[model samples]
Target chain A: MSVELVDVAGLDLEAEADRVSARIDDFFTSLLQPPGDSRDQLYAAMRHAAIGGGKRLRPLLTLAAARLFGIDEDQALRIAAAIEAIHVYSLIHDDLPSMDDDDLRRGKPTVHKAFSEATAVLAGDSLHALAFEILAHEATHRDPHVRSELVLELSRASGPNGMAGGQMMDLAAEGQPLDLDAVTRLQQLKTGALIEYAVEAPCIVTRLARDARTPYRGYARNIGLAFQITDDLIDFAGDEAAAGKRTGKDAGKGKATFVSLVGPDRARQQARVLVEQAIDHLSDHGEEADMLRAIARFAIERDR
Target chain B: MSVELVDVAGLDLEAEADRVSARIDDFFTSLLQPPGDSRDQLYAAMRHAAIGGGKRLRPLLTLAAARLFGIDEDQALRIAAAIEAIHVYSLIHDDLPSMDDDDLRRGKPTVHKAFSEATAVLAGDSLHALAFEILAHEATHRDPHVRSELVLELSRASGPNGMAGGQMMDLAAEGQPLDLDAVTRLQQLKTGALIEYAVEAPCIVTRLARDARTPYRGYARNIGLAFQITDDLIDFAGDEAAAGKRTGKDAGKGKATFVSLVGPDRARQQARVLVEQAIDHLSDHGEEADMLRAIARFAIERDR
Candidate 1:
């Protein structure tokens, strides 16, 4: 649980999370640190938004997947950091007063609450741009084709038809009767899209063949939905302080969520089934994917 | 001035704008076409924000620059469309209640005013993603290096150090006195960054040498500043109806601008000088860059 390196292939979840978090910290520290004169305020706010907090779940997924391909750690970490930035930016925007209106995230004041709303918006927008910038950099991959594919895939997963499109659906579904199919589709686009991107990114980096990617995509699809269901379950029954954000807000707003749609027991049962299915897709990689298998289990089991 | 084809070398400025606008409209028309089921509203909102209603100046600059290298028109048009999407996304975000708080743009309701706030946010976010998606596509550039270059340059221009950074500076500058240098830096990052990107993107596509791009960069810098100066001038003197969006908001908010830092006549003269300098950089290409030259002149001379 301390800052020591864990056996990455082992099931030391806490140590692995710390490892990912350390990578994120080091990356942002250099990215934002400087003589930073005029832009100090902005750099500070961006740092605050991106640098610390979270379980580093998305980056962990990227790392685990990268390990599956024996990808270089530095290159994988860079991509993981970009994915973390995009996730954090989305969180920042979603917490804005005009959006979810949340005041807390990771048990601290949300970006807009800590900074100004204008700063929050710009910070989020900048992070989104920065994510693509990181992926496009030569440092991310030797192959420009790989770099380009990463950008293309990341944008598709995060953009209008994917992450952004899912968000649009979520907003529209609020207080409306969204059936299971609609909810599943919404979750796939909103949370699922980025999760899929994180898991599939290593495939893109290693230039996995089309057929070789199906298992990873399938693994991602199952876990993506499982992750959201667990999130909803946490919101349904867990403490807000432990969750690091508000809970029950969904029910407060009459938002259609898996837990609400299927009840807490059924939701928990469904998430377990998904975790197994998700792990099943990793069978192709055998023991090389143990970390990924560990993560799929962690998805539904983690309390926070 | 209608949607008729204009002489690319001549000064039929309005006709050229219309031509670019038509290209933009056609591109989005196909992009957001039917069979759009549950996400119809999102697609519709995206179309309304992107298609039609502007001078299409950014896209025109891109097209003009592309033509300088004899780049393929279809390829150039695709890049132009992506640039326009980025521009529109910025506008949509800027018009948000937490940002500029404008209700009008291009003589129509702003995205947030026409749609919901959440919808506007997602639409803008989606468009941002779409911009990168378009650029990273094989259709944008055959070379993966070129595609990565486009993504890198565009992201840098639009991200923290560029457009978003400029916006952060701007929001912080509101109700505060900003000197000429500060204002220049702000404008450079804000409006100038994207303008420079538009002018230089074709250079990336054509794989021009870094040193060979200096003239284009210089030209873009001058015209970018001129564009801002004229915009400030328009805010100072032009009618709101002609300007499309509310003008003089800078003055109303006690925000520093070119016109405010210098007198109106001085700002106008400065813009004129910049336009001359901008056009001078294109002397290397002669009449081959006439469209670019015409656009430079139009930047400072147009009523809007």
Candidate 2:
């Protein structure tokens, strides 16, 4: 039986997720076709890393948010693809021997393992470069200012002050006793920033004034925290086989997650609270925003 | 007895170079000041990698190119800083254990050595993100189109089909024999793309018609090739003390290079020829283009 949130119970995200994944795959295929040159290996590695697998949660969030503003599907697709590209690049780098050293990603051998370490490094860097390239492409928006804003918004979300900063903190905090507030801050930066960007990017495309983004930002922020909390909950008590990659890694490494500071039950309870609060942020909108409300309720459903 | 290109004789680049370096240092310091947070380590790592080192060749190239178009100095400086940030980020990643695995860079411990490998990786990724962020920042250019173009050009220069692809070739070519054509193609991507962008980017800022960029593109391509030839020549015969990093790695690794294919004398001669051709591309410009001419001549002067 499929679990569903009460208010968003009728929302069928699977079909939408499949569509987003298919669109992203098509984008990658078009962008990364074989070069018939030595660099073809680089493209191959990029394809293996990005082409398939993983729930299209982040991109779906982007699309869902775009639906709120009735953004052009093609423009929304680029934004979604750019965000997913960044997420994929991060995964490639995170799996390198110098970092998390995971042998598997998306249930396949990581890029470094399948290709080589040097190739993996370059592949990750290339994809990181591709994110900005995609956003800056003229086709992303008719207005150059919108494209520029997308680049700026995305760069800040992924850069030193956001995801990277949070990652640094995560590395430093290992084996250290961190309080709930500290952990929350770390989570906010590590994963919340990108999720927030995914939700707010539609506003950029729609040319909605910056001040009007408050409710949307609030909705994204709450869901981002809720998503991370759910991820931590899964890592704490979830099964290894079901999770694909290793589960219980947090407890194994003695990392301080939401579940470590508070019991799993309290953590799950807090995630539900966050989801409810997230849905409340969209009260100003009607049926057009139902997908966003659905996304908030289903944020914790990211099993992958 | 300093070496100087004969055609561009008496051009004093030292004073200008110093100014550019100081400006870049100041920009980095302003952007990456101590955050009074755990991310201070990341900021410190970024500062270490970017501040007070190298010839600032990429940024200086950007400034020199901008001079041809009479772009604003502050705008030129942002363009310069953005290019330098990409260069610095590449260097940081190039020194990673999974990539070039170098212990030293610019006579200091590589970021991975001074900081953790994880920190170095994150710092590199952050700086890569920063390049686009800087370019997309409104202060970089008043026109959004210019800023967007800057992001596109810079990202394309560094992405999979450019520097990263070339790097992949270099990795694959190690221990295998290669000829002049293969090495040229590799170096063009590995080092040539960014240099080309450095010189061509000014045209993007000025909104020069795409066709109008042909001469500048030719100039950049010639100097870019010349620059790599000079680099291989230096790597063949230069000193570690003067270079501030390990030298002779190409020979040590049996990697094919211009020197390997053409011998040192021929490589130097070829580099000089390229410099002259690079200068020839600016036949349309007058005294205002003197600095660009000087930079082309000095493209082979990057000892560190």
Candidate 3:
């Protein structure tokens, strides 16, 4: 009863995202149950932060990439869940009082606001640990070598030299005069690393060699930058009610963003160009990659 | 040339600790260098928390356990450094304002105190990611299976079901009275899980089978409790200067500790008895386990 690739033509990515989001919610529901009564509250906090909100874009990227290889759905879902865990954990920590100091996330109280700051911190830490645990588990992959590679790549992407490093740059950049190159590097590290992982992880799971991955890698990189550019555009001009969060935050903080460095017209033009280039990398694939192409278009077109 | 077992008899465990501590320092110095200049400050914050002033007991435990399997010293040092990273990362987060709120750690300013609260969070989070990064690298172990197992064990020990769960319990227990059973469970999940991993990681590196690991498991469980009991005892009556942190904190907070529940004399006696029992678990290894036995004694006798 496998799903047919032909049916995916003219794919509505927003609907596909909602479908994967439902799967992701079920996945988190199963995994977040506290082991014992003592930890019920901690698990609850994790569930609250992770289960209900966000675009689930990273996981969707994983699923879309996995479709290119005909990877097992169950296995791909597990990897997607792991990637989402890392994404949510970063959000939980980023929203803390000491970090971005946000009281609201996705239209509700942030983890630290709903729970205590200490619980929020532990929940974030635990979710980070859970990401690695899922990747290393035997259930994630049959080959130990594949699992090790996944673990290595994800850890490197998230560690001091990767996502965390990018985050440090972001925090330090607030109200500082960062050049366009510096801001690009910061965005690449902050959000681009995980996006790269999402696109590349399925390759690892499918045992694709380095030379064979150039197209996928190129596609991921271009789309990642495009995604960020659109994010900046949304922050600059989108409605708060439509975006589900504060708007014009980059301008408010006087932070350098794509929309700030370039005029809105130029930024939008660049995002459209990048999205077209990203889609060009998928020309080798047919209907199997239709969702990826649709998502590339959606990257620039979406309001949120 | 390798040191002989006969030379390690009547070992100056403190000197051995210092030797391993130096190795751990060198390891962090190499890994914490930022790949690009952008993340130098985050790397700096991680170095500030990890490199200086602590007992380094967990790493010592790893090195000691590796000795029993005749593992390569270089390999053992890498694993030990990874364990130390996790320990230090935990301490960094534990001392944050949202947690224990300690300004001083090891007689120096806590990471949050020395750096900004934001840096402290990133440093700790980055360190946690770094631990798994070290373990998954090919240099940690040649066998991918061994590396995967090491990653799985470490992640499980640190995740929601283990260290984080215990942390949740600790926060919830701050103002409430917990029974001895509750406290014991908390300590087991908090510190005991990692201690067990420290003892057992070498077995994975050596490919030691399940049945052969019973004694090591027994030894680690007993000594882990003994170590926590001794910590409570130190907090009860040790000198602030010698311990390198504030003393009498548990009592001041009116929190229940081993000393508070069992009385000073009985808690001391209990720790000694547990340490002796822990040593007995290593009897089968004869001279090969001398360091393990010595460490059991040291767990109770150390002031900090």
Most accurate candidate by lDDT: 3
The DockQ-based CAPRI class assigned to model 1 is: medium
The residue-by-residue lDDT of candidate 1 on B1-304, one tens digit each, is 2223234434466677788889889998888763365567778788889888887878899988988999998999988888888888899999999999999998999988898787788778888999999999999888999999999999999998998888878888878869999999888999888989998999998899999999999999999999899888888876354546555768878899989889888999999999999988988885668788888878876776
Ranking by DockQ: 2, 3, 1
Off by over 4 Å in 3: A1-11, A239-247, B1-11, B239-247
What lDDT tens digits, residue by residue, belong to model 3 across residues B1-304? 1355424543668688889889999899988886667577788888888896798888888889998989998998888888888889999999999899999998989999888899999999999998988999999999999999999999999988788888888887876868888888899899999998899999989999979988887889899999999988777776444556554777566678888888889998988898878888888786667778778878886766
* Model 2 chain B weakest 10-residue run by lDDT: B1-10
Ranking, TM-score, top scorer first: 3, 2, 1
Over A163-232, each residue of candidate 3 has an lDDT whose tens digit, in order, gives 8888999888888858889988888888899998999999999999989988998898889999999998
- For model 2, how does the per-residue alpha-carbon lDDT over B231-257 read when each residue is reduced to its tens digit? 877777675435565547787787988
Cα-lDDT of candidate 2 = 0.86
What DockQ class does candidate 3 belong to?
A: high
> Candidate 3's fnat?
0.89
TM-score of each: 0.93, 0.94, 0.94
Which portions of model 2 miss their true places by more than 4 Å?
A: A1-11, A239-247, A301-304, B1-11, B239-247, B300-304
Please say which candidate is ahead in lDDT: 2 or 3. Answer: 3
Best of the candidates, DockQ? 2
Candidate 3 global lDDT: 0.87
